[model samples]
Target: MEDGTKFRNIADLDIADYLDKDQFARVLNNATSIELESGQTLFEQGMPARAFFLLLEGSVKLTRLSPDGNEKVIDLIHPGQTFAEAVIFNGGPGFPVNAVVLSPSHLVSIDAAAYLDVLYDSPKACLDIMARISQRLHWLVNEVDRLTLHNATYRLVSYLLDQTAGASDESCDVCLSAPKHVIASRLSIKPETLSRTLKRLSDSGLVEIQKDHVVLKEIGALKKLIQLETDHFPCTDKKNTLAVEIH
Candidate 1:
């Protein structure tokens, strides 16, 4: 059987969450499974994005090139996440970034033209999908706010807290999804800066590093640290006077 004709379990696809039963079956009928190796290019920056993907295993990084030819890591994708979905609806240029596989990865590529065909059959589904995508857009907007408005330590704290996976205990064990340098890139910080931040965090009793794993000694303290950063921003002061806001 060809790659596109191979039978795949619907349960393995995270993109299925965005559609109803009938729509999922329709889309699945046109899906294809692809396995890629580490250091492989799933799609380049300008390649025609005819489909979106659901990663079942391993990791991928979305990146863009600057005018000076430096690559900036946009986001690191882990398993159970759908990527390139925006391109299907973008209706403009090709994919906005290059999606490179960081490890051996298994993914399901959904044919965008087929997906749109399904949507055309049901007008309500189109609104539902767009609403869901728009809802998810808040995260991207907040990411922009984080990158441009916050300091390096705030971003690192937010990243660490995100890796905790909702551990309610006073302490939590976290494993990094990628190397220090890749992670630094994803966080938009220099590798040396990440190292220094980690050391400072370690010395401050906020966390302890063990090779690729980091143990958050005080998750509460880390949360407070983020809040502290928020509280201390000079532009966001809220006093006993008129309205104050940070742009």
Candidate 2:
């Protein structure tokens, strides 16, 4: 993966842009890449946080098991995104959730100690990392506000709008990063509720579903719906902005 230009093009490795080529090479040298099959556990909660990971391909679910043995899906990480980042610095030296592959996946593991050493050597790189983390924190705060203030229908609609924020065409295809049940868990709703919401939106001519893909037929109407809700709820960054791309 470190074949010169190939590494620089990876969207998840945008951090390379902040460093000189030599510094980027040092960052790459300290990392190891591996492939895993579906149902594999990448890491577990409470384990020593020796490293953080980048999802080069496929998806991974970050989940925490509750006291009653129920699993709460925190997030479904997409390709070109990193997870367990907070553990290396902001949080303690332990993973707060379990990262399990939802499909056959490729990942790059960067040793925390080595990566931190590189960060300390470059002030600009450190500031860039902080900015990225701050973006994520903002998204998380909005996510919490969304969950607490909105109903299932509003949350689902808002999520659909967020996913299609950058699409250029009138209609766009959206595939769930994980399964329906996993997505429902992340949205804090039951699978049945998600199905119902999709059906409701489809009946209203907003979206159409084909197998696992949701073709958004009415992007304008969807945006208007979210806008109407935003007027009532009043979020800071309704457009998703840099927080969405920080993945």
Candidate 3:
């Protein structure tokens, strides 16, 4: 268990991006921290959502389980990201997906009632959350567009290019943030299909796959192969394109 002071500090950190000293301190007083092991579930689909979580370390996979017992990965959460907030605010009976740790992880969990109280009392905090939700929706839209594109190679290469944001273009190495199976689920592609697409790209001298890492041999060739605008393929701002490359 974390000491009260440390718990409060983590709580303070969660809302620090949108709250001031007084408000952060108040929110901190009502928050707690929880640890999860790899493969442990934080929440399940159709379960009442009573709280929201801010991931402080490690990664969490958001997945939806179908009636036939199939699981489809929806997204991966990294540090500095909040999950289940929309469900909490929407007063929904259950979350739309299941959340499970991909690795040993630490999270700050805020009770829905407490968070809602703060949101009602703090207009700025509400605005901040609304803006964040809007941005996330925009990202989801782009992801849908990418998936709808008929070309599998385009989807695979576009996903790779997206991950290169903020990386040194000089280096060929690119780390994949998620396992191949999880990535395939998120992309709505089969693992075998993804593997074949990657192999084809490699054969064309476009990229190299080394274990969990990918090395872009010729980015220009990749952009052309994917039919994406060359100027927009790698993105001008590096950080925004980091996850796009390997997702």
Supply the TM-score for candidate 3. Answer: 0.80
Clashes of 2: 0
- Location of the lowest summed lDDT over 10 successive residues in candidate 2: 238-247
Indicate whether candidate 2 or candidate 3 has the larger TM-score. Answer: 2
Error of 1 at 84 (Å): 0.7
Off by more than 4 A, model 1: 1-14, 233-247
C-alpha lDDT of candidate 1 relative to the true structure: 0.80
What shift in Å separates residue 136 of candidate 2 from its native position after superposition?
Answer: 1.0
Instruction: Name the 10 consecutive residues with the lowest summed lDDT in model 3.
Output: 238-247
- Give the per-residue lDDT digits (tens) of candidate 3, residues 143-239: 8887874445667777788777765444467777678888888888888878887887776667888998999988766656556432346555653
Give the local distance difference test score of model 3.
0.76
What does candidate 1's lDDT look like per residue over 14-43, in tens digits?
A: 466657787888887788878999999999
Candidate 2 segments exceeding 4 Å error: 1-8, 233-247
Model 2 gets an lDDT of: 0.79
Taken over the whole model, the C-alpha lDDT of each candidate is 0.80, 0.79, 0.76
TM-score of each: 0.86, 0.88, 0.80
Q: After superposition, how far is residue 246 of candidate 2 from its true place, in Å?
A: 30
Tell me the TM-score of model 1: 0.86
In model 3, the runs with Cα more than 4 Å from the true position are 1-15, 217-247
